[model samples]
Target: MINRRIMMTSLAAGLIAPAFRSAFAQEWKAKYPELIFAIIPEENASGTVERYTPFCAYLSREIGTKVTLRVVQDYAALIEGQKSEQIHVGWYGPASYARAYLTGAKITPFVIEVSSGGIKGYYSVFYVKKDSPYQSVADLKGKNLGLVDPNSTSGNNVPRFVLDKMGIDPDKYFNKVVYTGSHENAVLAVQQGTVDVAANWWNSDDDSNLTRMAKKGMVNKDDFRIIYKSDIIVNSPIAYLDSLPEDLKAKIKQAFLEAATKDKDAYAKLSDGKDDPFQPVDHSAYEPVVNLVKFIDGLRKKNG
Candidate 1:
């Protein structure tokens, strides 16, 4: 009789567990009502929105809350949005994420993109037109240079870091230095002769800003060449505000981890169909990048 009583209690608890979870989820949804996920534009604004919208919808469904997407105009805006907490979550490049953390944003990184090869990083590269005379960094002296954005990791920080290591001050080395605003624009600057060389991100010959543009028929990939490449940079991460309730953070992290299998279409759209599922990450993974941003900031202060 005691054994029967215990079994019935266990059965009752099993039935109640899911209802408890459902109520708990609704509790946070009522508090948040809507969550904002901000992104830095690696592509054009429209393209960035289209690519990320489905992923936002997926998160909304998984977390039982409304998740909306915001494509900030530039990396700095994305950083500021998070710093101000107007943005609840952000997809940040390594340097941009570091910049936010260093500037006093209360945020924690949760997931990083994994390449289809299962690698967790990518490279910054310099692209020049195929028919151009510039053959190397030295050959490009006095030529115009295009960088993506001030807060860009592959587009600005890593390139500046590498150039400094080589004793090249871009301001003194190039006749004119311009921010092209986005990686796609940086590549377009090269093709359009607005800039002789442009710094952009590259994952492989098969996966990169150039290749994506090529696939879209925006540019013939064969018409350009990579004149320089930086060492691997830790892949970009998806980060959320540390101020969020603990359970919400857990839900957001879980939603991202399971999105690849649970929402393959959204994952593929965000990844350009070139990456694996999101993998867990944290503050430690980005310390090197934080130091790198600090070093770059130091250079700017010294130069001024």
Candidate 2:
């Protein structure tokens, strides 16, 4: 005689097996019905919207899942989403990625929007007013310098790292330092003479932020000069949560790399008309960023 409890338990298991099997065999679509990608609105607002719309559409078609793009107000929002595992994919700057990786977010399928000559990196330039006596990094000694933000790679990390290599400690070298919160703010601070120097990232092309400011009459091209430049650091990276299923991770990576080459319009939109193409990359490629963070930590200790 079968016990009543045993009979009920067996019946439930029998009913659930088919459902489990059906889900398992339903391909990646049924696994994650909704795929969400996050981007920083401040850093890449227009470009992000333009690129991700069609890209998500294509990805939805290929993976048979509902892909949605979400934009956050700032880098912190995107980083938080990645930490909570709420975001499946993200486009992160190098310093932001380093901070996330330190907190356990996984880096995968590193890709960069290229410019001329298939470049993966950009440089940090220190700009000062033309009439200012500051002509080079050395001139900033004992003068105020404006940094965009502590977590900013091109604005803060790169500038700090370059100064360290030159045997000049930013904290000790500058008479005062201010955090402007954004690269645009930093540029404005320098242009207004509120700060002695400002640091930012830009390609060799003349049509960058610097040029825009020059064009808008906010600042003249001849009015400001580059006082210092840092070594090229890799552009921001796209990262995923480590807990994602390995197969799903592989498919996402494959999709991005292939899209850059296979979809010309998708690639162009992502690159902002720059000659950038998505190329395969790995976590280890960001070693330089890690090293720069370590150098920054040392500076913090010294300053403290």
User: Which model scores highest in TM-score?
Assistant: 1
TM-score of 1: 0.93
Q: For each predicted model, how many residue pairs clash, with residues at least 3 apart or on different chains? A: 0, 2
The lDDT values for all models are: 0.92, 0.75
Which runs of model 1 end up more than 4 angstroms from their true locations?
1-24
Q: Mind giving the per-residue lDDT tens digits that candidate 1 earns over 1-304? A: 9999999999999999999987977787788999999987877888888899888999999988899999889878988898898999999999999998998989999999999889999999999999988889999899999998999999999999999998999999999999989999999998899999999999999999999999878999999998898889999998999889888999999999999999899999976899999899999999999999999999999887
| Candidate 2 global lDDT | 0.75
Question: Which pairs clash inside model 2?
Answer: 114-276, 130-223
- Candidate 1 scores a C-alpha RMSD against the true structure in Å of 2.5
TM-score of each: 0.93, 0.78
Worst 10 residues of 2 by lDDT: 39-48
